[model samples]
Target chain A: MTPFSHRKADTVAALGEERLISAIRRWLGDVSPPAPLGIGDDCAILPASKKAQAITVDPVIYRRHFDDSIPPCAVGAKLLKRNLSDLAAMGAKPRAAVVALTLDPRTRLDWLEKFYRGLAACARTYNLAIVGGDVAQADKILAASLTLIGEASGSRMLTRAGARSGDWIYVTGPLGGSLLGKHHRFTPRLSEGAWLAAHPEVRAMMDLSDGLAKDLHALTPSNAEPALDPALIPISPAARKLARDSKRTPLAHALGDGEDFELLFAVRKNSNRASFEKTWLRHFRQPLYCIGNFVSIGKRPAGSIDLNAHRGYEHLR
Target chain B: MTPFSHRKADTVAALGEERLISAIRRWLGDVSPPAPLGIGDDCAILPASKKAQAITVDPVIYRRHFDDSIPPCAVGAKLLKRNLSDLAAMGAKPRAAVVALTLDPRTRLDWLEKFYRGLAACARTYNLAIVGGDVAQADKILAASLTLIGEASGSRMLTRAGARSGDWIYVTGPLGGSLLGKHHRFTPRLSEGAWLAAHPEVRAMMDLSDGLAKDLHALTPSNAEPALDPALIPISPAARKLARDSKRTPLAHALGDGEDFELLFAVRKNSNRASFEKTWLRHFRQPLYCIGNFVSIGKRPAGSIDLNAHRGYEHLR
Candidate 1:
């Protein structure tokens, strides 16, 4: 028998990416004093002496994240923007980034130069420096990964674990149908995220990458779950158009399509969501939709509000 | 014509990884305040408020860095160790790491569990936490990237550009034949690097990844270069054995075979090399060898001391 033959036949493909991530999360148990957040958040929060720093690493691969139809520049920009979106979820100001790219030998120098140009354009807007990175050769696929560092303001870093039972959840911008290629072009809500992070009432936060149905489950405490109102989910115009063309429910798409890249956060129930949304709209052009409230675990809502029971896109399978 | 076909056909595989890296270094420009070292070094040096934080990201892909003969655990360990070796080169103490993995769907669950176990074993020795990471699916290759964060103890973090003309060059342990599979098991020189960092005499430092012949050029200033006493190079027992089997010179393998992962550093001319070596032996069991000295640009040493003129392992070629 082969060396690995003793193990079970179950593979990551069988267990799925979500289960694999959860397994990893369980393996890396708790953080010490200097680290605030660990495996389950958008970014790993660390105590950098005087200030808190949120750091995250994200990777995009050819054929998996994007295809030949997408420009190389967009690929580069998306690599940086994904990490920036993580920082925004933590309510941190994007500071610097280090990128690592493994390219197929056939990748052109012109393509690479344009990729860096696109990455620089996105990084410059937030004063985020492209500090350093590595370039190596791969067999067939081209993959890019970025490690982003951000500093927390107001002496605290927002996390997905702090939402209370009565906290109201809101998602910045509409969700769903991001698979239509906007996933590569969507701007990270840096200013809006930074503004929300400094505010005292924003309880818990995270970016919506895995759709509302799955990601809302991440925002509330483990012992609790979100009770979302079906009608309130702000379906994106793109999502609506796709829904009309495909004869699918836009609400279902909004909750399960994934890759929305919008901030999904919670505020205290008494903090006046309407007022905050008004101020948010004035400060930013994006719309904010109040989608749900946290409820005790095993407690089902009485009316039409749906429990976040649907799973989003599971990558490995 | 294809969308990417309009540009010149100079591809990464044609120009080579080293030239591409050089072009990228030039494109990144200089590091600003709060970032001590950038682009060219193994780790990007950043100021974490009062302390210096050395950050690095490295990626290893299957069919490129490793194959099925190696265990999955070693793959995980090496991914983290490569980044840790970068931190060691910076004379920084490993604090934490974030990992990102892109796996082929066929990758077994047991392989992943063992992989994390190996990573955790290495991380535990240095009190480094496995903070966070992202997981995605790839079509064929399995790629893993690690982002390591280390805190610099001394006020000034080390870089590859501090060597003076008369400085003595030294390497920790022997080099070469790492491709025979020792590359997966080579331990990072973390303790020794941290100790060297605390002392004021060590001039410049970097880890040897792409062989001594090529990496030495990175140590010297732009106008200067290294003049090596080729006979003095410390060849590893493994390299010697491999040399005998292959009917090749061990010296050539030592100078050209990459992935040594040993710390190659410089000491000021005034410092006593014998005394420092004795001290290094006492603190760490590894041997340190003084192999060369820096010289003025265009100046040739007495007999044939190959002036770092030969290119080493240019990936993608």
Candidate 2:
């Protein structure tokens, strides 16, 4: 038999996930795009005739991100929602998406149909079309990757770069312990993002998928450091319940447990915070919390803050 | 172990590829996007303020699409090239792309770097950017899903729907036997597609990915049937060689083998064929062949053409 006959035995576990990602970034980092976009942001902004378009791609894999117990429709919905959240972070209005499904040969056709229907149901709410995509076969695990395209004026688009030292950091909802199930069903803050994009006070924005501790680094400028108050962190009900059953603090889960899929944004400190809060309450029934403020890195203990930031959810143990 | 723990064992082969794709189209088919685009085309056209943006996504899996013998860079290049071919089919100028990679945990970091470097080299030639993408871990196979975005005016874009009974069928280059290796290195006919799109005589267009026999159905309108001349089929040197070694005829390989990544398009029979041919010769040194014409389904023996059209590469046996 040829090498391909048993190629399924070869796996990617050897090099580890983080290293593989870094290698990819290093390889593609030099090709300067038409737009000034890079690999690290939630979405890459493209140059357009009228408004900048934001594009992002993400894949959800079987066993790793989900399992058989989760309905196939929920799987489809989560993948789409994750990409939508990326666009939301950039304050772009998602217009369309393409999904590529690479499935293990044993997947059921009925399950696949349910998945697409679920994705369609979610997309209908936003009026985003599922335009085109490709299908292929994988050997063992099934995976689906969604690429979302959205548009926004350049000035209105948000990124992790513009936050100043005195900017106040806020979150659209409570965070932590999303793995309990909320991670698959949570709605993306599209409307809130659209409103924030138009507001002059919003400085920097990103989705809190990898937990506040890790994603915070993406939003903070090199000259500044995030000074989040542990006591001020609003823990989710799931996190609170999980904390009650375990020795880990709810704050730890709030700070480190990833997959919250909420909006973490910074606002200009001098902006009308009170009015903004009132307006936010009037617009969304969801609770918003002021978590912390950005501070100059030189003013804080370097090693301590660095250690705290490095305490990402992945390394909770 | 939980169901999630053993989920990697589940495969998609049981459902088959075509059925899975059908399920996807059924579920997402109802979304009335802001644009008039739908799912069955090579690329989904999005309405932009000044132009239409074409988007497509494709995934290349280890072993299935390629093996370790093909260099990592070639693997990366092939994945991007495939997506580029889809854009080319629409006569769109590819502007940017987002790549999502799900790697088998054992994949080498160096190999991943080589793949990206390869993709960057190809992107540089077209002035396309590797804007953004995501990375995740898979249990077995290393797969890369690329979402490419391109632009063209609405009138300039091409689709498979415009072929009329009198339109002549043409292919930019010879086809077939890509499994011998051309599938990994063939360049997409972007320039040829662009030229055809600009020509007022071209009636319909699409790329030949899944053998000319199967893809022809996608290009032929419901009111018409394709009547291809087997003798006129331009067999690639690779296909000719494979046919000589095997029992199959070169024409069979040309019609049934896939992944040519060449443009298969239609031109109006009454158009200036001579001038268009001359212009094509001037722009491209590659050979162009006119092998067939569309006929009304009632004008031909239904069973005779059905057998020929059903000679899809996947069921070549």
Candidate 3:
């Protein structure tokens, strides 16, 4: 088989920038709530009175996180977005972030501008400002990492824990090989996370950067299993292309191909009835779906997907 | 005459750790901060209010930052220490830090532990916590970067722009090389920075990761000349060792060598007199030397010790 599966995973050139960003911006357009301390500046500006804070860090490698074929601006923007997405996973608001950039001379200044453009594009859109960071030229590869410092607001700050049996499991945005094209351009669901945290129904929340199966397992409480409906997943065209071969590799891609940057949340069945309302629909331009539900305290989901979870690559495994 | 300077710059290994950390801890130890969100945990936990917040990010590379022969653990600790020192530079109390580690598998975990041990050693003594970070495997050389997050208490924050002509230029700990042998293990002056921030006299501030010459050039405001006394610059054993061979080369090491992690600040004359107090018998572990004074606007000091003004080995140059 050809190493690259164009059918299963598409890119920005294919998705159309308007469609991709429109789909994303619709869900996360507002600014963070005013806080005395936050990750938005050089040092957190949060008020002196809050009890606790939330912080998360993420490192973006060149080929591992994204390909250099993409512009530098996108790389810069997405690096921050990746970390911001982690804070969103914890149901925390974006405060401020620190960036460490290891630059490669192979990347021209124009590329760096584009990189910052992508970064500024995200930060400006979300009202998150670039504060302070280190910059240097590298002989090897270009790398950027962001560490987001945030505050929990009043939400106890959700985590992989706090999920319940029978809770409806859902995902924000479409899924599949975001890597095909979306890897360098995916928008973090920080705004959606803030909204969800404000609502108090986002029992367990996380960002699915590492694919559905592995991420779901991470979110699943240690003692219980997660029951999912393969048919209900919000598969993107990328994943659909993967499955076209009928070898089941595509199905695994949908469940395993990582770096999607989508938010996966578990909600109590009784309280989630209003999730499909007009008010809620405003939070996302892409269709949202209930892929599965949590099961009783029992065995974990034994295997991944039907296409042979083992057939493909497994990182942690 | 080598293409590059035969002299090594003032680096961490040369400064010796005991002298460095002791000076810093004594200054800022009054602040005992805690972070379940530690400097190593993932991210720093700072205060949060009901508003938007801020944080800063910086990255450092190894050959570009220090010589490659240095131990891996020291490399690890230095990465985090540099970031923490940035927080101190801002006069912001450190909350925590997040790291991004990228290197080949050739990078030993044992070295990584020593790095963490150095980081932990510095973090504990500095009262800063390790929060969280990211790690990656790469093919080329090693790269470790950190995004340190700190809180500004309120709106009282320090910036480089705050420096003015006639502000007594001050530095925490000695100038010159600390990286010769112990560069990796040297601590950033996080504590002294916080204390100086609390004090009214200290004005603009920054850490001396880069040598005094290059860093001072950055600190010299308004195009004024930096006239310095070569005799005033504090010389370390590493610097002395480097100087012993070729007076010009190692002096360049003391001048251009980066990764000292010492605090460089501009304080008003007489407002904080104790900062410069040093007797012949008493060793000011982290001493602020009056190497040079800020000249009037428009004049560059002809004799100022130019750490970077002198040509040296290019880390990333």
Candidate 4:
């Protein structure tokens, strides 16, 4: 724990909103290809881009998204990474983001400063401008909502609805048990997503956010359902470790654990699978796994498990 | 007071997040020129635009922004209007927005639906697209954060840094005691702002949110301070009503009460004030007032009051 965390007098309420905002601004520093107008103004002015923009908003709330065990920096990084994953899913290059934070007045100023530092580091790494934001006082909870705007890589952008029957479903890396640490620490599969989007053979694509079991349904068309091979699912070591102390098996955790933040996409069935895998391996260090295929609704593979029997994390449940 | 507000089984927890999101999407309906990809997608795709974009984010929390007396619809409207006011300050045209809402599980579904209805109504009124959004469960408080992307009216957009000494400061409408319904119901000065930006004489502009006393400082350059004519301050009827039972005078309330979401701008020193007023009157039904001028520090006009003595509402104070 930081020294100031234990000091009651060093809270945000004691320092005041204006001072806190100034500290946050200082922590964010500057952005490359600086915005026409940035923080301190009513709005940040973004220059016109030739490519279509992809916009998304996601929030991390205390307890729901993180707990006291998580460092302030991880919490901040998680917020940006989660939104970045959304952009990755759309095969977009992150351009700018605006964040709104609601904090309990008693939150330590040190924690807030560290959070901004982590957020700034992530923004710099991604070359995304921290454009404009607002801070509000909340009664007890702390929450941060980030809206990321990115530029599409090409004319066509990927969505969850484009998967066709017989398309081979793929995941960029291992899945499940993200709660151990990977949930906030994992890197977003941005380059892989962009590469996949550029490939003509790649069909529908989305980031694995709420786990394969739940998210796969999104990529499955109304006339089809996802059929997964139990042996092919890339269950993570974390999922296996978690299964040892839980009632569920490793495969169950791999199928149902959310926050994997990996790229889940579909490629045309007619594409040369071996050649595509070779190209993907050349471009990315992350392992690629062809876990399943989208099949006509009532036609099930001989030994494939029933996806409808599994469930993933659901908010407000 | 809605039919479902008092029903115990009608809460968001009972209804679930997915159903509530579908209801919100239905409430928002469709945009005029439909987006290439919208809600339900990982990210909403916004077609390329020639005009520069202005981005901003602001959030409204349960008690900080509204109270039990304020209807859910008003609460939702207030969230969007606040962000709209920021765009108005920058003289930008509304384009698209993504909202992230954190709601207490026990919040009534009816209230949430009404809130979205109000938000959708406001978005439609401005022809702004509700592109995408996310929902999370909060421990207790209900909060909504909105990130609005708007198109700059022209090549150059207004900012608080453009004010010069001797520039006259003007306000678009009455100020203070916005708590009496005007805070949420007041129209954003969008058209007026665009008009001012198009005019060659408007030097700087910003929306008055934290009251005239505090907000004017944003428009005052480093070399100058704001000089106000007490009689010229447009004290609202609500200010006078609140003043009757308070220690502060109506003028004090006008200067420091805050949440007066009116446009405050600086006009060039040599601009023909009479001609400008006539043009403004011909364009808008809302009255405009020339409050004062920005003057070099310590060179206050004989009758002008010292702005340093007044204070406005500050969050987390």
Q: What i-RMS does each candidate reach, in Å?
A: 13.2, 12.9, 8.9, 1.1
lDDT of 4 by residue, B69-121 (tens): 88888888888999999999988989988889888777888788788888988
Tell how far residue B207 is off in model 4, in angstroms.
0.2
Best by lDDT: 4
Q: Check candidate 1 and list the clashing pairs.
A: none
**What DockQ number belongs to candidate 4?**
0.83
B34-125: candidate 1 lDDT, tens digit per residue: 11123321112233465646677788787788777778678778888888888788777776666777766555544555566667767766
Off by over 4 Å in 3: A1-52, A152-156, A272-279, A282-287, A297-313, B1-62, B66-68, B152-157, B247-254, B270-288, B297-315
What is each candidate's DockQ, to 2 decimals? 0.16, 0.16, 0.30, 0.83
Model 2 ranges with Cα > 4 A deviation: A1-49, A153-155, A301-310, A315-317, B1-49, B153-155, B298-310, B315-317
Model 2 chain B lDDT-worst window of ten: B1-10
Interface RMSD of 2: 12.9
The DockQ-based order of candidates, best leading, equals 4, 3, 1, 2
TM-score, candidate number 3: 0.76
Tens-digit lDDT track of model 4 for A90-205: 88889988889888777888888788888989999998888888889876778899899998766667887778999999999999999899999999888887888898889889
| Model 4 stretches astray by more than 4 angstroms | A1-8, A32-36, B1-8, B31-36
